[model samples]
Target: MAEITDDQINTALARGEAVRLAEPRAASVRYDRQLDRVIVDLTNGCTFAFPPRLAQGLEMATADELAQVQMLGTGSGLHWKALDVDLSVPGLLAGLLGTASQMARRAGRITSSAKAAAARANGTKGGRPRRSA
Candidate 1:
């Protein structure tokens, strides 16, 4: 491992501050039981909400568990201590609910006109080709 340097630490901190300033950060957060959603109140006075079921680790969480959310590191993230789950606030805001494979699994169950059209197009090409192996 490389040795740490004061200059490097300062540079990294500066970059983090720049990112925090440029993005909407959580001022407060809560789990709305009635709505079954996690709501985040941003420092910019904007509010955002999403269903807990759509988030990977949160899908099976009880209302009590979902209510255990805490803001992490300058409000750039959210953590559920009991569930051992951590999610990036910016990533969530950008429509990312989980890892690639997790998102793909969820997406596979969704039906859309565009997806149907694409499937038909693929079928016209004899569907997916078989591997040589």
Candidate 2:
């Protein structure tokens, strides 16, 4: 693997900060224990919050572990050190709970009892008919 130098790291950091400044970014992040939500205060004077459980890598995190939320690299992202997770602020705000595959699985979940019942009912009707060859 190619080694990273200190200059490269600094340059990258600078670029990240520039990008953050070019767009609305988080000014602060907090975990509302009472509401069980992650709240972010943006520089644009707007607040955004979401349930931690709705996010991947944070579904099973304890209150204390999640309360350690911090703004990463000039507020371009959020970092949960204890959980070893990092999420982009823009991505989260844009409704990306995790990686594409993870989001796909989440979207495909059939956890609702009603959905299960419907599936069973469909199965009784022979489920989906195979396409003609």
Candidate 3:
């Protein structure tokens, strides 16, 4: 592995500061049994919550395991040691609860009249345009 340098450390610190200014940082995190959700209290006095099932590794987590939530990396992430799970707070805020493939699959399973009509319209336009070699 390469050795760390002063310039690299400074640059990383600067980037972290920029992100801290723009993004919400979690002040505290907990799993609410009654609500069946993981709640995050932000430094800005904002509260965010999401069901465990929506997250990738947390889907099958029990209340005991979910209750072991801990903040990580200056509150930009969450960690569950027992579960061996780590989740990005920013990603969670952005609705990224799972992997790309999982999210795509979930999206593909959604059904609505608008979606149906759009699919029909696309079908009329030769289904989908073929990729060029």
Model 1, TM vs. native: 0.78
Clashing pairs in 1: none
Count of backbone collisions in candidate 3: 0
Candidate with the greatest TM-score versus the true structure: 1
Candidate 2 residue spans exceeding 4 A from truth: 1-18, 110-121
lDDT of 1 by residue, 4-116 (tens): 89999999999988988999889999999999999999989999999999998999999999999999978999999999999898899999999999999998899999999
lDDT, model 1, position 33: 96
List where candidate 3 sits over 4 angstroms from the true fold.
Answer: 1-9, 111-133
Candidates' C-alpha lDDT: 0.94, 0.91, 0.94
Query: How accurate locally is residue 19 in candidate 2, as Cα lDDT from 0 to 100?
Result: 80
| TM-score of every model versus the real structure | 0.78, 0.77, 0.74
Candidate 2 per-residue C-alpha lDDT over 9-36 given as tens digits, one digit per residue, 9 for 90 to 100: 9999999778867777899999999999
Cα lDDT over the full model 3 = 0.94
Q: After superposition, how far is residue 41 of candidate 1 from its true place, in Å?
A: 0.8
| lDDT-sorted candidate list, best first | 1, 3, 2
Q: Write the per-residue lDDT of candidate 3 for residues 1-133, one digit (tens) a residue.
A: 9999999999999998998989998999999999999999998899999999889899899999999999997899999999999999989999999889988887888899999999999999989789999
Name the 10 consecutive residues with the lowest summed lDDT in model 3: 102-111
